[model samples]
Target chain A: MTSMDFLLLTKGPLFQIAIAIFALGMLVRLVEIFALGRPHNYAAARGGQLIPGLKTVYKRFNPDPGTFKRAPFDVIVGIIWHIGFVVALLLFIPHIELIKSMFGVTWPGLPNPVVDAVTAITLFALLATLIHRLTHPVKKFLSTPEDYLIWTVTFLPVLTGYLAYHRLINPYPLALGLHILAAEIFLIVLPFTKLTHIFTAFVARWYNGAIFGRKGVQS
Target chain B: MTEFSLERGLNALREEMDAPVASFFSSCVHCGLCATACPFYVETGDPKYTPIHKLEPMRLLWEQEYTLWGKLKSKLGLGKQVTDEMLEEWEPLLYDSCSMCGRCSMVCPVGNDIHYMIRKAREGMVASGHAPEGLIAASVRAVNTGSPMGLQWKTLDVQIKHVETATDLEVPIDKQGADYLVLLSSMEIINFPEYLEAITKIFDHAGVSWTLSQQCFEATNAGIQIGSKDIAATLVQRVVDAAESLGVKNVISPECGHAYTAIRWEGPNAIKRAYPFKVFHIIEVLDQLRAAGRIKTEGKEMDRLSMHDPCNLARKSGVIQQQRSLMDLVADNFVDLEEHGKFQWCCGAGGGVSSNERAEELKMAAFKRKKAQIEQVEPERMVTMCATCRTQLEEGLEEFNMDIPVVGLTEMIADHLVERDKPDDAAAKAGG
Candidate 1:
């Protein structure tokens, strides 16, 4: 197919299919998780859990001081990439326009230059994470093939978006088409991989906090 | 009865699967931050000791049984099965290296509750006949003899007599209608008879009516450490039966960390019923007495004192502030370790690690983390609330040739109790 045709294919039917798979896959996964059903705790609680549970959902955004000291590189890089990724995803005009078109809602986007800078920093941070995983003993040992696969799927969209915005590829349509295609792949694979953490992390945090909080712990 | 096998282990793991476990497994990003929080990994610098990695078999089972993609993979023979061999290899990882300290659960960036998963994983290990021999023995002893250490009630009765003679106070036995029914760990009865004396003096001074149940004095639950809920429930039911028969208002878990968690937190759940009597750690009771102006003390300890918060007590049970409050009552020169309260390093022998003889070297290796924390503070004496933690601290410090003596917080509080006439008068005065 020509670059224009490829661009149209990615932005049209392919995008629709990707969104369907992403949404349905995520729903099924979430159902599988919640449907397992935690056992009812018969023990009396030491304190209220609701507020603490909600608090942890937000509190885990920052690592505790001791944890940060122990794994400073991971914590810092993790925070940078996450913030950068979110900023690039939501604050960039093109992404926001796409989101607005899909969901019928729009927010003011950041200036293109700022988004571009963030995208670059995010790309570097993602690369740093991969290198760290390959080197850090615990992370290297814990990582599986799926980890690298997920990392690639996660990294590609940002890398492709940055390249497309810069028109680094000879044909602009081809670059743009690749960027959209990369994002579609990300969406399709997300619910099947560790990338599902995007949704489940909050649930995990709430459960952890609630469990500990019931015992009057602040965790 | 069916013997333990890989199928049984797999079935146990399937039973252990719950929403929290599912959510935790789904959320793990493999960032390995849990290793930083784990004493085993932190001290040994071994990736194998990574807390999440220790739960790999369980995680695999979870994936294969729970998720659609994983189910598909398993049907196609592409998914990994938890084998008897895997359980054998992981025995050291699950039992030896892990204290179930929950520090890893505390620090997981994604909030995986890695230690919680490890606890559930042990159920499978036990069913597979892969549990450490020491733990298996302890569980057997706990079930048969009523104490993991195989101590009988007569052993505790002897300690009770010694405490009565030393303190010149009546050690009430199975006193019906007492305010609290006290439970003791075998470690306390065997190693620290003074714990009985301290509680005797404190109870007398506070005018709190308490008794020791001859029916079930032991509090430590090996079933919990060995990861067997049926055994845990049996142990818990003994305490429940004893407390109900005595009609005590509350049950006090002695200076034992896991014992406190087992009876106070996990007890009701294990038996699948709400407890008629409430449970409190000794420190929590002491703090309550202190708050109620029931515990009056005259002298403060002059030595430089610091505390090691037991993981089950501080991190798991949220009895953090109670110990600190009790410390402030009698400690004139208290200095907290750099990491104290919920963040305190474990003494490296909790959750049956101390019971497992094969884990001796790994247990001491894990002690290095606590040793480093203790070195930074250089306290003249270390105090803690849990019997297991206290024993580990004393042993660990001595092994490292650190002269910091370990003391139980309850005993320290007892040593400072003010001499007063008619303990009942003191209570009446406080009441008025």
Candidate 2:
């Protein structure tokens, strides 16, 4: 088979399989949250009604929204970091083309240089957070193998893609090919690790604000 | 005032936390979202004043003495030891700034329980003897003399005499078998007499048999505020013993925020079990009485009623619903503050702010959030469920030079009672 034919057959099938894996992983994650949030009858009474179920969430719920909201900076930084991350993820041409091919759709495109630069900056910014996690003594307890691995795995494709785009190596095709593979793996891994936080953060925050507001917690 | 000795004492206290509960304290992510909910953070605009930052001393101690990685950091001077000099920073940051209101913990995404975290930090401060001398003196008085103000029995009698003169209603005293044993904090008897008078006015109007005990009255519990659990429990034990000895069926907590917490929540736990007698915050009592149509009140003329829930009775306790229930009776226009419940802003006086003289500026600054919230109402009066809140808000409004009256939840209830006859002034105004 010609190189293009091999690329079409091998990369195309691998990508589809990777897509299925991503969907399944997401399903498992949603199931886990659904199980946790099934609304057990026991979580009804709150410690204080003024904050509207806030007391109960503290006493009864496993992770209270009120408790986590204390560090607004971490929340704000985490959000800015994640928004840039998702936009970078969707705009990468190979992944976007792959997604379009699977779904039989297309969206307007970004210039190659612009997309690569964004991918490099965002992934590096996330990499900096990872390095800070490993080094900061205060953050040491919060650090886990998963924390390091997830960010490293997330950055791999961006790193490889940046290397390919920058024309740093002789075999640009090989680097780009490896980058495509890593992107496939990362796309599949999104729902399984800390990335689940991306989907959960909004649901958690808005749900909390609404519930507490109605209970007349927020005047 | 900052003390040199307190500096050393604070270091000693930090050492204790390092030895025992450092694991619990060091665990936090500094997300600034909690600042939006914190009155202290709002007033100071200092990230360190936010609830998450309140744990920094403890976090520093944890790093220096515990966790292998922290121990490594300590060796490199990256992690500063909790030395005598550090107390200079920790004292005002922890005591003056924090109200122990638990609002940050309420909003925390990780369920950090910043209240307990702050309390643990305070435990370090308390053990170091870094707490306000007045609080220590008063709590010691409470331990030895059975009250915080250290009032003599004769003075207690004089106050009862005053209550008689004001209401023409007798408070059951040292009498066994009364239907209710009404508890007052030292603030009510020693500072504000009208709160006790309000209780009497309601009891007279409702015909409930209530009595004051010369043996056990004042309910202020500094132990809880300062994070000394033992002293907190002792504060509760006094009320439990008095009620048990007097054979009272119900224990009514005065409007003091910390006092209500000591009695209603920690009091039962302090007694090594729950008491058979029901614990009712004054607002809860008024609410039930109003709902049953047992008490009559003359509603205030103000159209807009903004009720601020004291953290103790509202966020700290679950009786915030009663604030609204009572508010429903007080005015035609009731605007709920959005950041109101467990989310409600503290009057900055709830966690022993009234007694900490050094905390006066912090208290006033903390009250700025509540004051701002009320200013939005453009109301005739602001109603609150705590005596300390009334005190804090009243003084806070004056400090900011705003002309709003701060009244108690019970006072509002009494005003809105149906049995209240329209004043003669109403008739004169009608004729005019």
Candidate 3:
């Protein structure tokens, strides 16, 4: 198929399928997790749990002092990529326009230069994390095939999106089409793969904080 | 004897799965941050000891039995099957190498409770009969006898006689409606009989109404250490029954880490009921006495001193400040360790590691972290509240040829108790 035809297909039925699967799969998985339900704590609580649970969802954004000292590179690079990804997704003009088209809401977008810088830095951070996983013995041991697969899918969209915006790798339509397709793959696999952590991480933190917090622990 | 099987192990993992476990497995980013926090991983540089990695069996079970993709993979024979051999290999990682200190849980970027998962993973380990012989034996003795060390009431009665003779005070036994019901660990009875004497003098001077139950004096729970709720509940029920019979207002957990956690935290959950009476660690009780002006001390220790916060007492139970408060009253030269209180290093012998013979070398190796922390402060002596930590501290310090002495905080407080001017001052202290 021509790049135009590929673009049309990704933008049409493929995109819908990806969105549908992403949404439905996330709903089902989340329901399953919550449905399992927390075991009733018969022990008397030492402190307020709800506040701590809510507090930890934000507190985890910064690594603790011990963790920071031991894994500074991971912490710094992780923060960069997360911030970059968020910026690229929510603040870039093209993404903003796409959201506007779908949801009929509009917001201010970052300038092209700013978006370009973030995308480049994000892609670099992702590559650095990949290299770290390959080289670090502990990380190498902990990593599974799914870890690498999720990294690839999560990384490609930014690469293709950046290439298309800069008009470097191929024709604009072809690069843009590949970027959309890569993103669709990411969306489709997110709920099924280790990437589900995107939604579950906060929930996990909340529960942890609640459990330990009720016991008056700062965990 | 209970038969061991792979099916039993897998079923235990399945049974332990709940909301927290489900979310923890779902949310682990595999960033390896937990490894950096774990003393075993940090000291040994072994990836297998990584907190999250130690739960691989449980994670695999969760995936295969719970997740759709994992089900599909299993059907196609692509999923990793949790086997007997795998559980056997993991037995050391689950019990010996981990202290359940909850440091990994604190450091998780995704807030996964890696330590809690380890505790749950051990349920499967014990069910599979892959648990260490030492811990299994301890648990069996705990259930069969009243103590994990197989100590009978006669042994404690002898110690009680010794304490009464040493202090010239009666060690109250089975006093109805007493304010406090004190418990003891085998370590305390065997190694530090001085603890009983210390509490006797302090309570006498402070005029605190307390009693020791001949029926249930042992506070340490092998069930918690061995990771069996059924056994833990049985052990806790003994104390509950005794306390209720005596009608005590508060039960004091001895200077033992797992004892405090097993009784104060896990006890109610195990028995499936809220305790009729409140539980207090010895340090908390002392702190409360100090706060209420019931405890009066005349002087502070002049030697350079530091504290070793037992993981269960400080991190798990929030008894950090209470100990420090009591310390401030009596330890003038006290300096805090670099990682004191909630972030203190384990003495490498908690969570049943001390009971497991094979874990001895690894436990000593893990103690190097605490050794280094101690060296940083350069204290002449170390004071701690937990018997397990105190025993580890004494042995570990002796091994390293450090001349530092380890003292129980309760004993230290007792050493500084102000002498009452009149016989009736004891009554006035209690009244005031």
How do the predictions measure up, each by TM-score? 0.98, 0.69, 0.98
lDDT of 1 by residue, A40-65 (tens): 89999988878888888888888889
Query: What's model 1's interface RMSD, roughly to a tenth of an angstrom?
Result: 0.7
lDDT for predicted candidate 1 compared with the true structure: 0.90
lDDT of 3 at A93: 90
Candidate 2 reaches a DockQ of 0.08
CAPRI band for model 3: high
| Each model's lDDT | 0.90, 0.65, 0.89
Q: A82-175, model 2: which lDDT tens digit per residue?
A: 6556666677676688669778787766777778667666765776676656654334434446566677777787677678678775455565
What would the per-residue lDDT of candidate 1 be over residues B241-324, giving only the tens digit for each residue? Answer: 999999999999999899989998888989999999899988889999999999999889988988899999899998888888
B7 in model 1: Cα distance from truth in Å? 1.1
Model 1 chain B scores worst on lDDT over the 10 consecutive residues at B423-432
Going through the candidates in the order shown, the clash numbers are: 1, 43, 1
